[model samples]
Target chain A: MRSKTRRAALAVLSAGTLLLAAACGGDDSSEADESTITWWHNSNNEPGKGYYEQVAKDFEADHPGVDVQVSAMAHEDMVDKLAAAFQSGDLPDVYMERGGGELADHVEAGLVRDLSDDAADEVEKIGGSVAGWQVDDKTYALPFSLGVVGFWYNKEQFEQAGITELPITMDDLYDVIDKLKAADLTPLSVGAGDKWPAAHYWYAAALRSCPEEVLTDAVGSLDFSDDCFERAGDVVEELIETEPFNAGFLSTPAQEGATSASGLLATGKVAMEMQGHWEPGVMQGLTDDGKGLGDKTGWFPFPEVDGGEGDPAAQLGGGDAWAVPEGSPDVAVDLVRYLLSDEVQTGFAENDMGLPTNPAATGAVSDPALAQLLEVRDAAPFVQLYFDTAFGESVGGAMNDEIALMFAGKASPDDVVSATQQAADEEK
Target chain B: MTRGGWRQRLEILLFVTPALALLGVFVVWPIASAVRMSFYRWKGFGPMEDFVGLRNYDRVLGDDVFRDAVAHNVVIVVASIVVQLPLGLAIAMLLNRKIRLRGLLRTIVFVPYVMAEVIAGVIWFQLLQPRYGVVDGIISAVGLTPPEQGFLGTPELALPTLFVVLTWKYLGLAVLLFLAGLQGVPDELYEAAQLDGAGWWQTQVRVALPLLGPTIRTWLFLSMIGSLQQFDMVWVLTGGGPANATTTMATYLINQGTQRHNYGIAGAASVVLFLVSFVMALAYQLLILRRDTVTQE
Candidate 1:
């Protein structure tokens, strides 16, 4: 009797599960009949989000029949979700693409659409493949924006602290830090709250100083003890020793620009912050506003250190790219062109923190702050594709880990270089 | 009629068929497929797949990361069995006394367990912040640094700190379970102990403990398994950082399989994890529990 009862209950449960599966199958068929496009993105910032929403509405209005579905997610999440979706044969039609190492990995996996053959004319249209976006002759991504990470500082704070010029080398940075400490202000309002922010100190410093060949060599073998690794770790130690970072930085994780070091700079609690051009719009209408910072907000190129080979004017960031997934229908190709059209890219720039991927939108971006950033980009000897994008995820993971420790003053440059090398060996 | 008997038997068979089919599909089939996938070389999403029997297992047992993850999981289990068990039991005994607002205290004590792991990790992350965080600032104001190493960033300290947080979050449930077990022990045993002039500790050890053997066994099984499968807290607060110092076997398996898309190797790791956990649960049943049943009979 007990066994009979168990059988009856199991039958009911099985029937319920089967019914749900059948219902889902029916919905998929109806959805297939419509012109639906799914986009995977990681733009969660206020302006970035607002920009995409407007683009969706406008794209829908222009296309008439096509329906665009934006499946936006965080950067790390997109990597996992896309992998799962791709495995199940349900990949989104379009998503953001990274170049260098990530681009190579994608092409190797046969997941890239290889826009080189068809996007040839458009490739030249967006400034001849961007060096960072091209793997050999083939193109997998269309560069929409060019960016370099720099320290955004308050001019007023510098003057108040009796600082005449921006720091040029490690010693100058230390001098400014001492003056700021004497003035009873936070020297650098950085939040080690996020591991990546901590990582930037290591990678960006290395980019500032490490030779370009060493970076290329490291990428090839996934080794880290190369000279660049030592330089990166040493710079982090120098920053840590000076108490230059914000108080409670190790424990406090960064949220957004407005709430992090940038917010502190905006409020005049600190003089400067290490960040990309992504900070100004983030701080414009601060609800959690700090004191003393008025309308004058600005950015300067990161300082040139004594041993650093990096050009002071060189931008530290790479821009976003739009790419189609392999096996996407022909409409996806047309949609890509539509999204990259001169009018849309121009509108994106005007409406959002849009740096244009389109050369046609070059004159359209009239924002002075943006134009200044562009000048830096043009003068840069090399805009290092953000290291994480240049290296695979495993390399990035180890780099960020050791880098975080370096910032905390617990680990040395030699340790970082060795740890990174060990991680690379393990990845192999 | 005998014909009617056959029809009755046929009806019974029909009812049982659905359950058997479900077990085949949901339970048996998936386990079978997982084991099958373990033998192949497949990244989660890529097109390239090659059949290589025992190779995935070979890679897993060979990898240092896998060995490290297992060692970390063992640490979690030991920490729970030794620390959380005794502390939970002691708390349960104290709460059993007639005190003012005992009901309120019980509810308040269980609150951390009720909190979401992400929320708990986030709150703890803030409270432990080095500069403005009240705790760290207080520690520093006393002329001592909050340790030379960043607590969460240190390889030696990260896993143990996480275990302590885990104990706090889970001890409430352990206390409640222990309280229920305490209640199940008869009043007669304690009364007899008191009559024999036994002290409180002696009574607890001699009389109350023997009756609560079943509860202890159950708790041990649960705590061991739960700690072995731990993920969310470590994911949110530390993200198994400072060079994978805090990575548990489950986290590593999931990260490699799902996050890194190395499905075959992940499957191999999962298989080993399953075998180890299975053996542990079985040992608990046989040594800790089934033996008690036999002795009782």
Candidate 2:
């Protein structure tokens, strides 16, 4: 019996060890062929996914002895997989990049290739949108799509709430919220559980409160000593105090299904959601009929902060870009250029996938709402990338956590500032 | 003497070599490498030149969120012991008697244990959703109001709600194990107890419980270790949020290594978790299970 017990103990120990081993050693081996260009993108849905496959097939057809392998996945899954691939040294030849602090880290680690000299013509065509992808005037990636964050609202809900015009200022937006609440409707639908969705509130507030120079300087110096940052938190805190969000917004996911924040807006359960150009597609996916809000959906830029020094037209946005990894063949660069060609960009625009960075495709945005967004994008003096992507994972994650705490009513605006500053110091 | 001969020794060595090599490669080597990595400040990628020397451990211990995660794991362990095991044992004892549809009932109870943890979490997440979910709908139909923030969304209630879900998911395994243990207890022992004027409760407490010690001890260890290392369910259900309310050490390690690219800190967390599990297992063997071995011998 003693020997039997000993054997059982040993068996349990080995079983636990094997489980741990399996978890740690599950990395997939990548093919070593240099001729194949592997591409990863977040357009996993129809039209966009099909367009990408067509693009790859065309590229492969044009260039003999070359293969374009495309993997389309959801955005969040792609991020997690890309992080794992980066850690394991199994990165694809060419993949989508969101330029900011993440790109800086990749560049510093010598993982990303400098594209300024190789894809100069494509860089010139994308214009200032390429600034987000640059470090000290050298481009590491080329922006394919560019758009801004704004209110994606159901017009019928606003009409029911007795709000006739879009709010042009912060106070006016609050009044709109009050009107919606009076009508027994949820004024806003934010997915604070996701953290990034809630963090966007603070980012929009900062964009409205701070000057572009201050925001830009903070990224360079890692010094968030500016009062505008704190004021931004205060703005969000005040908005939170109004209790304008849906009943369980803190735990609601961003775009999961009919009950998510985007779904709430899509189903007309909420008045609006502060989302990006991708909101329409996400909303459509959440609806039963697939038509989403359709003509009832409207867009307005994030409301301006009254008496603030920041430009009203200065927008907060981010876009997906293509970047070549270090040691990639020249064909990777060529493929990236082809993606930015007028024909491809025009197709991208016509499909309403996003606002293409290529200037020649500017008129191809057939969606009236998107066209209005393009007008706002053009008139904006500067565009700030999403703070999380701009600051990279470490600082961005810390900032997001604190912002989420504030949304949960556990942290104050001052706490948000101190926490962010402390996190920046630690990351440095 | 013949078993210890050179030929026999060589045969044993040859038989053990493959297993030993696999253990070294997968288990022993990775543990040692993680220990070495815990001392450095390396992202998962790139070189490992920056040696921080226990700084990662210091940071992890100092972080409030990490402490909360550790606390949550402890709650799961305590809940499993105090609630899940007893309920499982009672159900097992009840089902061991002659009953109609016994096999079907056993199968129904055991079904949840076979379901994937991620799938269970997702299903529960939908069921416990605030206003639109079946739970809330049922409560409203019965003329009751669900909590405003929902169950999993609120910080105070999230961990307890998760415990309930965990109990629902795992109580079947414990019941099945105890049922097997019950079969091993000879009917003669109960007959002997009854001859000594023992009641039904006396028979259970004095006869069946003592005989089932080995199974109970094994389950205790399994449940504790499972609680400590849980990841899939909590991740899918909460992603350790509303505020880090459901974060476990495993989830925290994944968040650090995979999401934040802080491999050094993740390695440090992993080492701490391994040491905790190891120490607990050793203590259980030396202090509790040693008596069983001694008596048997």
Candidate 3:
């Protein structure tokens, strides 16, 4: 009986081994095709996904014997999968690249193809926004979409609170918050739980207080020694004291469901949310009627700090770019160029995904508020990438954690600067 | 050796070899690689040329966030033993009685055990949201103000709230294990206790409880290990926030490894976490389970 039991166990174990081997072996067969240009994108939603699929199909039809495989997934999942692929040395030919410290790392490792000469025409089409995807003035990727972070507010809420003017300064912003509170409406809906939403406050504050040279130099030098960095923290500290955000905003998610910060603004439960240009679509998705705030939605650049050294025209933003991996066929570069073509970009703008970086697609933006945002973006003297993205993971994660501590009332302004410096020192 | 004896030994080896090989490949190899990688300053990509021995361990130990995570893990461990186990035992004992709807009560108690951990965390998150959640609604209906920051959002309340959810999700397993133990206790012992004029409480303390020692020990062991490695619920509900209030050791390791891309420090953390669990298991075996082995011998 005991031997019979052992025999059964042995049979089960062999079966499991065969299953594991089969699972591991299946992917290698699919990866052998050299003509297949694999693309990984984060546009996993309806219009974006379908549009990209159509683009790939058109590309395949135009170039016979070439297969374009498109894999669209959620943004976070794409990042994780890309990281895994990088480790395994099995990266896709063309993938979505958010240019910043992440792209810098990939460039240093020679994982990405230098598209400086190859896609120069597409880069020129993108104009100045292509600078974001460039390292040391040598382009490695092509920008597809770009926009700035701003306060997306409800016009009806502002009128209800009797606030007639858009806040252009810190004091005015505070006054608006007071009026909103007096009107019994939440002034803002920040999702500190995500950390990135809360970190934007510090980034904007630093941008307003620090000079352009200081901000740029700090990235290269990793030196946040300037008093302006601390002052930036102080600004955030002061803002926190106003208690302007909705109750439980610290725990609320950014844009997940009906009760998220964007949802609060969409449903008119809150007056404002500090978000990127994509907030409209996200807000629309959360509303019952699918209209979101509609015409009630308005945008304003982050208010300037009083007596700040920085230029008010300087903006903070980031955008998605397409990059070809090293060892990928020249066809991958063609795919990126095709993606940046005027026709594709115009279609992207019309879908309201984001502000297209291509100059020709500027007129395709249908939203009036988005068009105004584009004007503000164009007028800006300098555009700083989002700090967390610009600074890479190690330094950015630590800095965001400290900033979050301040938001939770656990750390001081000085502590934020020190923690950031310490983290940066470790990176060095 | 005789032919029959050799054949039997060969059969035993054939049965166990496949299992052993699989374990070595998956479990042992990764652990060994993790230990080796802990000494290097690697970003998980490219070559592992930078060998900064012991620095990763030093950094992980010195980090305040890691210290907080360790403390949170301890809190979970202590709570599991003090709160979860006793409550589970009490419920199991109640269900063990010959009462109406006993089977239904038992099945209902076991439901959460079968629910996926991530789903349970999300459900609890929805139920405890500050304004629209059921918990807050009930509180408002009773004329009491709910916490303004909400339970999972508040630093002071977040860990405890997570502990409550953990208990709710895991208590079912403990109850089922204890019920199985309760069923194994011979009926004659209870009869003898009653013949000795012992009441229900006395019978439980003198007979049923002592008889249930082995099951309790096994349950305790599982609970301790589960608490030490708690990740999914905390990750889903809080993501170790409102300022790292609910951060546990596993979450901290993941944040370092995956989020920060600091594979060396994360590997160091993995080693530290593994060492802790390994030592706990060894000590439990040597100090507690050894006594059971001795008694049996």
Instruction: Choose the strongest candidate by TM-score.
Output: 3
Model 2, stretches more than 4 Å misplaced?
Answer: A1-36, A60-65, A74-77, B1-4
Residue pairs of candidate 2 with colliding backbone atoms: none
Q: Provide the TM-score for each candidate, comma-separated.
A: 0.84, 0.93, 0.95
Q: What share of the true interface contacts does candidate 2 keep?
A: 0.46
Residue pairs with colliding backbones in model 3 are none
Q: State each model's CA lDDT, in order.
A: 0.72, 0.88, 0.89
lDDT of 1 by residue, B1-297 (tens): 698798778677767666676677777776776787888866555664678889778878877667888888899999899998889989888887678999998998799999998899877665555454555777888987874435664567778778878988999989988889999888898899899999889988887777778888888899999888888988776666545677787877777676444567778887888788889889888788897789779
C-alpha lDDT (0 to 100) for residue B75 of candidate 2: 93
**Least accurate stretch of 10 residues (summed lDDT) in model 2 chain A?**
A25-34
**Model 3 regions more than 4 Å off:** A1-34
Best by DockQ: 3
Q: Please give, for residues A1-428, the per-residue lDDT of candidate 1 as tens digits.
A: 85876687677667957854763463242133237777777776666677777777777787788888876676778877766666665667777776766667777777778887776767878763366777666788787777777777777767778988777677888888898888887778765645666777777788877777777667767766657568767777877887776654554445443435556667666777877766666566443553324456667766676678765555568777887777776566666776688877787777655567677776677666777777777666777777766775555655665677676555788877776676567556
Write out fnat for all predictions, comma-separated: 0.22, 0.46, 0.59
Q: How accurate is candidate 3 locally (lDDT)?
A: 0.89
Put down candidate 3 lDDT per residue, B4-87, tens digits, no spaces: 999788778777777777797789989998998899987767778789989999999999899999999999999899997789
Ten contiguous residues with the weakest lDDT in model 2 chain B: B9-18
* CA displacement after TM-score superposition, residue A218 of candidate 3 (Å): 1.2
